[model samples]
Target: MRYAVALAVAMAGLQAMPAQGAGQRETGLEETLAQRCDAAAASPFDRDRPSGVPGVPSHEIDPAIAIPACMAAVRAAPEVPRLWYQLARADLAARRFDEFRDMAARAEALGHAGGAHALGQSHEAGHHGARDLAAARRLYEKAADAGFAPAMVDLGVMLEDGTGGTADVAAANAWYLKAAEAGEVAAMNLLGDNLVAGNGIGRDAALGARWYRRAADKGDGFAMASLGLLLELGNGVPRNMKEANAWYRKSAVAGNRRGMRLLALNLETGNGLERDPRGAVSWYKRAIEAGDVMSMRLISFSYFNGTGVPKDPQEGLYWLRKAAEAGDPAAMVTLGLRYTAGSNVPLDFERGLGWLRKAAEQGEPRAEAALAVLGDAPPGRSACRSVLGDYHALDARYGALPARFSGTLPAFRAVCAGFPGLKEDDVRRCHLLNPDGAGDFVRRVRKQCR
Candidate 1:
């Protein structure tokens, strides 16, 4: 899963300002235009536009016309900070970092915080330059002090992470509260997260859900995703899978990867939506493209079982190992078992145990069982004792062998052939599609087969 920012650090973006320009003019000509646009056309600056850029959202603007129009407007009003800021926004969106910096600096020097905020975002993300968290925090502070709500959210993140200075949880929550009070949707989401975790605020899931709903109403994808989680888990709210799926759909539509993942998983299982393997795969692919590494492992499992795609063990192992190496703990556990059992490759106990160690270090409780096979203790025994309930669930689900797990059927029969009261198939389906039940069968071998 992506970091919340606990997760991803993206705070908020700059909203368009109402001011157009101060009405000044400059000379220069058609040679200055970058990207695709005609110099003769006027910039599309509409004062009445309530949201987005002057007249249209960035996505609606024709790239062939945007840069040229903004350049013409800047030339027509050289000293206008608003015009410079607009061009800077356009430049930054177009990935023209040098031009963006120059224009944004000019607008910032003229006392416009929008340009400064954009520049600070670039610094925070280290776009087209070295990462400089200190510089980013300072720039964000400048913009926030100038009454920029988005900057307040960004500053709070830096403070929370100690990016520019000492980690100050209370101060971070304060900034988030300030921006939320000012009606910044992203700030509301951050503040809600803090409250839910009691990081710097009181732990209150009800209050957190309220804040999430408020931001969701304002069309914030992160907030929508958070609200969906609360609704789905009944955390300070009644469990309503249908409502949760609706919110997940909204969040996914708004480009939230976490939402896309959950919606995809739900679609696959018919949890709240109709089971549509193809649709699930589509959403999974989208989330994967958006940098959701965990999706790789899930998609790989689908491939292995031919649940949502063609059964291709080679391709499945490829993706599974890739994700595991990328530090996905569940993937690591699966890969560990694969190596240990020589499922698709030669058996390599040492290497398999090494994979388990990596997953264990990452606090994957599941990895502890496989680690125990190597006689590694303290950590293993403690991990097992801590997750006794999980082990119970594992045993209850896979204590007996099912016909579907044909690959491990021989081993299961040999070990549990005469064992009484172990017959079960109702919960055996889990063994068919997932690696989670591997431990239950393995424990039987270590005990009876020996």
Candidate 2:
């Protein structure tokens, strides 16, 4: 989620370059030094690694080891563009931005496609103190035209998003196709998304599925999850719950947070697997630990209803508050309602209104609607509005209530019983909006209310 320069975007440009001969150094010594640099800095996406040599991801490159080795290699073969680029990569990993700029510039001047791409990334990320999307795009084009698959993908993204120029969906698709044909997994995944969504590309779900499959086969966890969703919904593939569950499991195991949340939902509901509430909770916890905020909301529900765990209202409220604090608008609305209604909490109208106002500022429709009706009502009318707001929010989120919700209606009625100041108009409004469908109960309540 590093928006400045996404890891995939930065890594996509590290294409391998063949070593060019420098001065009159011995071939053996030059080869030896270049090999050392490659050992420390070869990218996993590099297309031309020596046999049996594994490529390293940028984040995994140890600057401590790579920097010194690449520097020595550059010293030995100053004319070798690859060595200079490798030194730049090591500097980038170490956050030595100025050093990276200098070395990468030198490497690009020496005809290294990866070095050009690196420069593009720096410009795009504002590492030069100001973002230059136009410069980034030009550099990406140069590298992409030179047959660097990662550069092709990055350039496609820029064109698709119109980051530095007019949007060109057709041009973006062409770049994606080129990169995908060259075996860029990120390109394959993005191509699948565009094709499926028909985002200025041809709508071909089956073809999109094929591209996703190819990327998933390359061990892309995000692609695995996308394929699973397609299979689950019969969008691009036939509905196959078992197959979908298998893919979801694979994606989750591979550390995709979306996959983890989806698999947990299926496990909890027995949608595509045997119901295992305990297992579902375990996965939800794992997702939360992985920084997924939605899972916090789900786990809160489990705690509230004692599903797979003891019913602990305080714990449930704790998770709900955590979610709200983390900027979940839905959680903020729910927390606001609970506080205003004094449901498992002390009545604090001002605190509840504050939460609602915060959510409304974020454009949460539910909070906006609730505030519209309840913001300045008198005590009795406010109590009535609180019940209505709580019911509406719940119905919007979950149409069918579980056994745990059975107490909610009775609790609502109790509020009405206590608020004798209720007007006939308030009771009529509640009856009209209530989904309980018990007109007789509403009539009887109307008769008894003050």
Which candidate should be chosen as best, given TM-score against the real structure? 2
Q: Which stretches of candidate 1 lie over 4 Å from their true place?
A: 1-64, 125-129, 273-278, 375-450
Give lDDT tens digits, candidate 1, residues 32-131: 3211222222123322112333334444544344555566556545665656766776666566778778877887888778667767877777776788
Best by lDDT: 2
TM-score of each: 0.71, 0.75
User: What are the clash counts of all predictions, listed in order?
Assistant: 7, 0
Question: What is candidate 2's CA lDDT for residue 182?
Answer: 85
User: What does candidate 2's lDDT look like per residue over 1-450, in tens digits?
Assistant: 232243333223222334445443356556766787799897655544566778677878887777766776686679888788888888899898988888989889998898899889888988879899999999999999988888999999999999988889889999999999988889999999999999878898889999999999988888898899889878878999999899889999998887887888788768779998899899889889988777777777778768778898798889878988999787787778778878666778788888889989999866776676557657765546555545644533332123324434444444454645345554554454443443644454445443
What do the candidate models score in CA lDDT, each in turn?
0.66, 0.76
